[model samples]
Target: MIRAYAAHEPGGKLEPFEYEPGSLGDEEVDIKVEYCGICHSDLSMLKNDWGMTQYPFVPGHEVVGVVEAVGSKVKNLQIGQKVGLGWYSRSCMTCEFCMSGNHNLCQDAEGTIVGRYGGFAEKVRAHQGWVIPLPEGVNPVTAGPLFCGGITVFNPIVQFNIKPTDQVGVIGIGGLGHMALGFLRAWGCEITAFSTSPDKEAEAKALGATHFVNSRDPEALKALTNSFDVILSTVNADLDWPTYIKLLRPQGRLHLVGVIPNPLSVPIFPMILGQKSVSASPLGSPTTIAQMLNFAGRHHLEPIVEFFPLEQVNEALERLQSNKARYRIILKMDH
Candidate 1:
């Protein structure tokens, strides 16, 4: 076991300090983490917003690192291979969902946040099957957020089968929405940004939004009935489901991905009447995650990011909460 520095929530909040190295089981691969990114989910967990967090918690899921050691039985990875891990740490592989390639839906799909430790530490032991090979040209620090934020956006884009002829609306332009726009653009779809702020219009266009619609504009929203083929809702706040439903075309979908902290009112007319599909994914499956990474790499696509030192994790997270971070804020482990 090697000593690792991490920010842990001893009880009330996360504070940076040294954490004792823990033993690794033979089924795990010990990773020397180079970088980890602050995700909104981390904030949710640390604040007991999720009600599943354990004390002395280390909050991070978007991890990129090099394999330091692997069990003899590990056949797929080698020492020093660059790899990445995400929100999910482990899942019961014997479950029906795991066998069916829908591991995200597994009854025991545990997170890197909940069941085990996460990536804010200088080192982490990850399940071999959960580790993904990083594309050569992408730096590990840059690759970290792709594991969570990137996949969160990419899964819905591909799942919805969005095409060039389709109009796609991306709600909220903070972290996930920003990446979603890039994915949609690479897929050659016409994208519209539905944001509450007028100032975000320029930034939205820069991120590949062809059209910007102020969500506050009643007339503009009224004119969009049956306009979009799919809308990926990335906002964490309660959405205007009634207005958004009108923007969908018959057979179009309003795919919800973001998690709201409170109850939301859903308008039944959105899909019940038109036979439209309304769905959301927990995260991408392993196959889908691999495909999304390769697609991003091949397209030279990178999510916009700002770097924060490991000690400044709280500040970084605050930026994410205040919607100041352009897309993501990656934390580097100062080894």
Candidate 2:
């Protein structure tokens, strides 16, 4: 049996647990997890915050590891290779969505958090299709967040083709927000950060945000009306739809990758009046994920992460829920 950290119920009452490490399937690879990032989704599931989670769940999706073994049917991967996995575990590749390279939206898509045990443990077994090899010289601990939060923002940015000199705004300065600012700056875009907290101005600017707007300030909001060429919301809180929507330039798209549980409230008049559109992404396709990883490697883009021992998974979750981590928090397996 492989050792894992598990929450038997809500609120992340996690403890060291064991489970059967059944033999790998024909197309599977068993990875010895090196580092795993703690995401808010993990906390949500642990607490049943979203109310759709299955119990006895081990919450982790941003997984980075080394291949420990591979099934006979596996190809394009080898033992000892560095590999990483994100939210998606499996999807029906034959479906229209999957066929169009949008596997992240496949109706039959199985998540790493739900159907399969995730990376908050010593080992993770994955289908070969969902695993991607890491480039040499990248630290697995820092690489872990790239699997989820990094990719969440990067995918939408790439999908919308936000280019150099393009006016972009990142709405939030949390984990995903910091990553978004870093990626936008690396891509040579002109970036503005939208936040309600004035205390984040210095930190946001340090992450390459060219401007900062206090979203709660009427004057600041007015100054930005119709200003952004592209804006992506990284905050998981509700937004003043008309306010943020009006900030988009004509034909500009607003992409959302965050989970704002409440229904979006936006006036049709503003969207129609501004000629704006709304879009979102689940995470990213494997192809795009690989490209993002390469880009992060080339640009030296990475999140500032706090490290914790594997046994400290519960502590890490508490910090993540409390917004205490500087940007990212990761648990290192003691392999």
Candidate 3:
């Protein structure tokens, strides 16, 4: 039996719940969850905003825990080993993408909280492959968000072979953008933050942004025409697509990690003339996640997190929903 907090209905409060998970599989491992980060996606699932959430939903994916048990076929992991799990809990290992080390792109990937329970609990289970071991210098208390939000921003850096010399701009500066600033700054890029909040400017610079642009300022944005090598949009809110497109240098990319609800109305002429591109990616593969963890550890990069007890999870969710989280929120499980 595992103890957890679950929502019984859409937009419902999470309440105490328990379940018996019978017969753990050979390739699987049972994780005794220590801390779980509350991502915006978790709140979205809780509210059924995506219309894919299941009731009795246990919403957590940014998980840090220990291996309490491993199946017969599981190797490279042992009891009491500390590890973390991200948005994806499983991927069919036989796919070409998986074989090529792109497990996150696997067609039959399973989300930790989509069809089953997740880490808003005392214990969770997942295939050994998706359970990443923490690097030596990383703090367990603050590492949870790296599994989801961290990777969402970090994967692009790996996939695109982003250069330290590149002039990069990050949008939103909330959960995802803040982390992106840290990573890009450590990566040696000339970092610029595009945010509407004047109050966040100082903090953005503190987080590694060398320059701050009030995204609402037309003059501020207009001055930067064809200036950036890459602009990573981390906000879910819609923006002036053509304006941002024009900000890119030739061959530049506007990559999106945010889950915007509406269709993007882009001005194709600017992209065509500049030979620019727009792209997006999902959460990263296990291999990429491991690399990201190592990079984070080496650079002493970690998410700025606000802590909440598991019992106060509903409040934590509310905080995230209200955009009141400092950067990221984590639920510390009780022993």
Candidate 4:
């Protein structure tokens, strides 16, 4: 029996739980989770916000661990290898998207926590293809978010073919936005940060933002009209969509990685007149994820994180719910 923390009901406290995972599948690997990052998606699943939560739910997807066991058919990974798993646990290998190396977009993809138990346990199982090897020089403790939040923001850069000379803007200087700033800077782009917190100006700059625009100030936002080559929105809150659209230069793009619950009402006139575009994407595929990890390793880029023991998961959840996490929170396995 593998020990884990699970909530039997939505909005209930997570407590001790155990489960017996039967025989592993041929393509599956058992990972001994060392550090699991608590993401907002975990909170959403706990509350059944997306209406897809299954009770006795173990809510963790951002995981860094060592491969403890591999099924007979598993290749390309070996026992004792350190790897990270993200929101996805499996994708149908025969799908068109999977064949094209866009496995993250597979329609039949299996979420790590959507229905099945997730990495909040002492050990988790996933298809070998969904488990990415961590590059040398990346810290496993802080690398967990890269699997989820990091890849969410990084995927668009590759998909859009964003240029190194491009001027990029990142909204919300929190978990995802902070990582976007670091990656955009390391990619050699000029970075601008759109934040409501004036106190975060310096911190955002330290995180690789070359400019900080207080989104709370209409004048500050108005002055940046048609300035960005790409603006990456990483905030879940509702934003002034038209204003953001106005800030895009001709042929510029506004990409969303954040999960904004409401339908965005954008001004079509501006997009049409300027030939601007709007797009969004989920986490990257295994290949793109590997590229992100390699880039992070080469640049020594990492997420700013707070640590909590796995047993204190409820407390960590509360912190995340209260919006008190500095950037990201990692649950360290105490067992």
Instruction: Assess each prediction's global lDDT (C-alpha) against the native.
Output: 0.82, 0.86, 0.95, 0.95
Report the Cα lDDT for residue 36, model 4.
Answer: 98
119 Cα displacement, candidate 2 (Å): 0.9
- lDDT at 62, model 2: 92
Q: What ranges in model 1 sit over 4 Å off?
A: 1-11, 17-21
- Stretches > 4 Å off in candidate 4: none
TM-score of each: 0.94, 0.97, 0.99, 0.99
Which residue pairs in model 1 clash with each other? none
Better of 1 and 3 by TM-score: 3
Error of 2 at 5 (Å): 0.9
Task: State which candidate, 1 or 4, has the greater TM-score.
Answer: 4
Put down candidate 2 lDDT per residue, 1-335, tens digits, no spaces: 88888888777578877889787798888988999998888887788887777767888899998899999999889999999999887777889988998888789888888855788888888788889898755667699999999999999877777779889999999999999999999999999998988999999999989999888898888888788888899988888877878888988888888999898777787778767898887898888889898998888888889999988777777888788988999888887
Q: What is the lDDT of candidate 3?
A: 0.95
Can you write out model 4's per-residue Cα lDDT over 151-269, one digit (the tens) per residue? 99999999999999999999999989999999999999999999999999999999999999899999999999989999999999999899999999999999998999899899898
lDDT of 4 at 237: 92
For model 4, the run of ten residues with the poorest summed lDDT: 261-270
Candidate 2: stretches off by over 4 Å:
none
